[model samples]
Target chain A: MTHALAAKGPTASRPKPAEFIAFAVLAALLAVAPFALYPFFLATALCFALFASAFNLLVGYAGLLSFGHALFFGGAAYIAAHVAKVWGWPPELTLLAATAFVGLLGLVAGALSIRRQGIYFSMITLALAQMGYFVALQVPFTHGEDGIQGVPRGKLFGLIPLGDDRVMYYFVLVVFLCGLLAIYRIVHSPFGSVLKAIRENEPRAISLGYSVDSYKLAAFGLSAALAGLAGGTKALVTQSATLTDMHWSMSGEVILMVLLGGMGTMTGPVIGAIFVVAIPEVLNRIGGPDFAQWMTVIQGAIFVICVLAFRRGLIGEIAARLRRTL
Target chain B: MIPLLGISTQALFGQLLLGLINGAFYAMLSLGLAVIFGMLNIVNFAHGALYMVGAFAAWFLLTYFHIGYWPALILAPLGVALFGMVIERTMLKRLAGLDHIYGLLLTFGLALIIQGVFQNQFGASGQPYPLPEQLKGGTNLGFMYLPTYRAWAVVFSLCVCLFTWFMIEKTRLGSVLRAATENPELTRAFGINVPRLITLTYGFGVGLAALAGVLAAPIYQVRPLMGADFIIVVFAVVVIGGMGSILGAIGAGFMLGIVEGLTKVFYPQAANIVVFVIMVAVLLVKPTGLFGKKL
Candidate 1:
């Protein structure tokens, strides 16, 4: 509850017309962006954006810093990939199945973790996620270090085939938008308000007669679902779901995305996700034993600097200066 | 030699011994965690990295300086403690009045940095540490063969854990530490140099992790990832033990270790996740943990 996440929770009541127009413009830009941007790169960025937005719901809004979200993201990706590649499930079916599985995963994780407060809560989620990672590493279906690869994009609902890169890009784009809107609605909903209240002052919210744990659990569930949606879509986009997706480092990356974008702000995670995803790729372009190798080090430096100097992140800082929620 | 289930007595004892050794590591690491949390109110997410540093210190001492295991045990922890104190003085102390999560984040960041640096310097494939002459070979127990180094690990860590417990729970110095934990301002009122004490306490806790690391070097490959691997399990151990009670941390660590060992013998698939499953069950039944007094 320090820095931007602690600042006036959900100050804006709703997504304004301007904000709606802004989103429409952004969506439009994204749609026409294949000529300007790499489809795979854009798809990856969108997937992470969705992941970060989901993360922001708990962290930015509810003040729950879950360090093990990879359970949903990577775990769902694994499920989606396995179903799609082996079982030959349709894209829609795989997405739905993955989302459902991860949502259930989230509920159990949230239920266990929400019992503790503060640092203990973070640690529990992390430990559980790490256990999930162990399962991924050891379990037969996950293929251990090899991961599930060359997964077919397949047909969405057995109708629209998503074999082409453009079609896959739009599929990812739509999923990202839908997930983003769902998060926006959740954050602005009365339920979202309660989450904010719990986040702001748990004791006060409890005294006010709200079933705080349920609200927290519900938030956790929704967050995990959206994160699942992103991950499942990512498997389709990348045509693979590697162990990298579920690693604790990926969880750390998602946190960085949320922190970098502006934890509570709608656009923050999206902007942050894109920025973070691009940095390593940019460094890799300058590949050597020196510069590219420094990516992880730089990423670690970003975490330290963000916590120490700028917790509000880029969009957060902008919003702070403008005296408005970004 | 009693075999409870269909599992052989020999196998059971071996797993139990292995579990005991793991529990020893858990107890020592959790003790460090509990100490830091009680005094500094910081979760010290960098703990695993610090442990990694300790193991690497041993590796470096032997690889370059030709320092033997005995001296590395003393010197490695001392160096790590000093580094930890520097961390406390510069970075963590700045976040005194802020939310504790900042401390968690800052330390997590430090963990990433430390781990990243280690990974960069030493590739992910672990460097092996040779066994010291003093702790090599094995003794044949009535039930199972026990490696001397593993036996030493369990015994040495238990002694350290108990010594730490004694110092913090039984002595006048322990009372002062307790007073500071309760109310730093009140303790500072008595001219006790509370800030310095806080720094030293963090150092001591970090030293505990380093000590565990040094012990583990001969057992496991000295790798950058070793601490990260163990730290999460230790965190689960801490959660079950309850953060407030030192004895609880020590006891729970050992118990869970045995539980894990038994699980490995019976249900191997569930071994890695058993502690976490237990943590979830504990939270469901008692969120305050086994011995936790506070919410």
Candidate 2:
């Protein structure tokens, strides 16, 4: 693990021009993607990218694997949709309310979850999240099966109305970018260094006088909050919150995204999220309805192959090969 | 209305009995998980899926082979254990040197594959498996009418759990197993085949889950999603109970089950979340879990 930590050092210290160029090109491509592809599909990818990046914050950087992140992501979506649809709040206020509400929920969840380490932590988070899932299922606010649908995407901050699909796409893009930058900043901060230290060697970090538990709790909260951001944004974009958002399968999907892209790399989760979401959609288009059901099988196969064969993931593998050469 | 603490005594007893039955399954599943975790240092995420397979096995036996519950109980576990052994030999064995997370991921993938295939074949609807003739009837227990099979399930699971506890705690083989868990390399150096022990331990753990599955099939509908749904709650029970002690897992499972059942009586809407709430509370007070040792 320490060796893996060292592998990240060179990339952390420098930001090359190529990285900026790549981001610019990706952003340009995304900006134009809505015109070519379905806006809904692009928005879905954006939401997942944010969600996966949020997940990456914990597993990739903090060495914590939470199997229950769907609770935060999907739970917040339900809440935001309910608020926007039922209460008739403007989109901006609904997003804020959803993020704050889910963040608080995450704080509570994180506080409970950080008590155990490693696999126990994963199980605990998963259990708690499942509890949330049941609540979503049975609760009246979720409308049982129908969920809170037809959520009005009102004016953003009482200005710049977001009724059009292209406008909504750009709104989601901005939010996703903000989330990505937040994660990037957090990973580069001194707090993140301590988190990396804890991940590498917990006892050593504890011996160095860092409060490891608190750091872990903080990371968990941040990850949950960001996932909430994604979920809240998604609710607005989709104009609905379904049971699918909070399901355990969704949690697994986010994990797949992070694992496929590159766990610790900043850009990896975004790429992975896009690929995971797009591949299924693309396959659906090509293979038709029967292929839609097989998407899970494909995802499962990908998970097995990725874990068994390419542990480094896309960006991580590239970085490893570059390090060996340089 | 006759009230025992503002509720009918018979109804209370019935709910308690139901709670005990649920606890029985929780105890069995978590117990297997503890055994596997103790020896293998990996949480068997597929325990629930294996449990589901146990139920399906019973369903298959009855439908295809005309085997009754009596034979299926024994056969289902054996079949699952055989499958478990095969899994150990092939995929799980290869993951021995990797991070523990990979074991979880591998089992998760296996679980998805298994559940997905079963769902594709059987669809999401549950298949009904009738109880055996002997255990089909009910027993009048003065206070409430008790279904014989439910009572049998609770008592039988209790016996199995205790028997396993006794095997692990009292027997010489148990000592060797404990020694293996403590220091596998040292035990291996002493000519004990630790790897083989690991495989057997996994098999036994999975068998325990299968046994629970068989027990549950007659009660809950034999469904593909049944195991997946209950496993998360079991994970919570495992956390609340603490993974270190076998007795703790059993005690916590039953305790939480009763609490959940009681919650259903008083506040029906909260029945599903009561166990999870208890888990959160337990985690807050004792992060190491009630019986877990700090690593």
Candidate 3:
């Protein structure tokens, strides 16, 4: 048990040169991924990858398992879509506006949810997000069950038009890369160490004079904002923002990605996201529509298997083999 | 036909009765959750799914085998308890001594699989459950008319909750259960079969949930997704009441249900979120919940 917790915890080692090279290689691959794969699919995967990474920041580092991240991800999508379609905001501005709104929402939610510790924290987040879903269902702007749709892929910065699919894909990639870099910065910062300290032993951190709740709230807010970025990017990519984004199932999907890739490792969530997004699409292509119905069951099975046997996850296992923090 | 705050007394009382029925469900489900959490140290996320399964089980007994409600009321919970014990013995046993979060994740996975399979088989729509012959009529009081089944459900669930509380707080088996919960290692040292006791406690809690589901089948439609949304509200109720005391859970459940019903009558717009709003308010003032002891 101790080993399992230790394995999932963050390493305090400095970033090695090989890790930097691997990161550069990954970025280059992503840069060229659009040429080999469908840009739309790649773009969608990137959005989810970002979402998983943002989620990883909380669950992996801070050791706070929030079950309602869908509120931020899906809520931001709604806000971005509404502003782009109704308020005639440009793509970049709309995304920014959405991220900012979700960040504040995160602060409020984090404040209330952090009042309880452990499992209660998870339950509270879930209940709060469900409440948000009901509000979205009743609110006029969200259009209830229909959701906000047909959001324009307006010009980027009012300069480069995103009307073309490739242009929009490139825009998504840029946003995703920037989000990734920001997360990397955050994870490696001194604040990250404090978070890890709290994760390792909260009472010890408190004894050491760190305001643990404040740090947790900050991490939660930042994670929520990054997830918002992913959601906003998704809205622009898909040209729609619907209730599916904010549903509890969506929250479960993100958790699956984080777990599947590897929790607490920077590389795990991205890998997990790619596989999660690709698996469904692959099943749709290979299994026909009838077999597609098994996706939820399959996802559930993965969750069960991961929890029971593969707690280290794909990247975590790989890192264990290489004896280096990925 | 007298109006109270511009609403007829009949409508107000009718909603209040509905609220009480809903409260009975919340009380039962939350009580089950609290019991499971105490024994297992893991919140049972599949609880809602199991409740749904229980409802469907009753429906199956009635539809496929022509078993009536009275028999199903006893049989369904027993079947669910057996199923729960198997899961506890097999899957949950492996997760002992780990962080509480993994149990939640595993059960969550189980919930998804259960809900998904049922959805695939039944689709998303609700199936109607008929009231038994004994519970087919209504009784008119001075203020409002109350359906017999609804009143029975409220009274029966209230009795169950109280009986559970009494058993846990007063009986010898309950004392053993409490001792195991407080100190499993020490209890095991005393030659008590702690693990088996834990298993039975889990079964008891799950059986309670199934019993609630059986009661709910006739009151609400026996739907695949019925437990999904209902469970979240119960969680809020749990948060408000705290999982420390069983009676606290029951009281909170009934109080919040009435509060929700009152919202429907007074301000319809906030009825859906009133429980959640109350949760946030409770959290702000009392972080440990109303009856919760600091862990």
Best by TM-score: 3
For every model shown, what is its TM-score relative to the native structure?
0.95, 0.95, 0.97
Model 2 clashing-pair count:
0
lDDT of 1 by residue, A6-58 (tens): 26433436666645765777788888988898888998899999999999999
Q: lDDT winner among the candidates? A: 3
Q: What is the alpha-carbon lDDT for the whole of candidate 1?
A: 0.89
**Model 3 chain A lDDT-worst window of ten:** A1-10
* Chain A TM-score, each candidate: 0.94, 0.92, 0.95
After best superposition, candidate 3 residue B171: deviation in angstroms? Answer: 0.3
Q: A185, model 3: CA deviation in Å?
A: 0.9
Error of 3 at B67 (Å): 1.0
Q: Give each model's whole-structure lDDT.
A: 0.89, 0.87, 0.91
Tens-digit lDDT track for model 2 on B1-295? 3477788877888888899999999999999999998888888989989999999999999999999899888999999998998988887887877778888887887788788878878889999988888887897877788899989999999999999999999998999999999999999999999999999999999999999999999898999888997888899898888888989999988988889888878888999999888888888788787887775
Q: Write the per-residue lDDT of candidate 2 for residues A1-326, one digit (tens) a residue.
A: 43544554323434445555656777788888887988888998999999999999999999999999999999989989999988989887898888889888988899888878889888988988889988898978998788888989999888989888889999999998888878877887667887888889999998876678888988988999999999999999999999999999999999999999988877788889999998877888898877777776677777777877787788778867765310
Judged by whole-model lDDT over C-alpha atoms, candidate 2 comes out at 0.87
The iRMS of the candidates, in order, is: 1.2, 1.2, 0.8
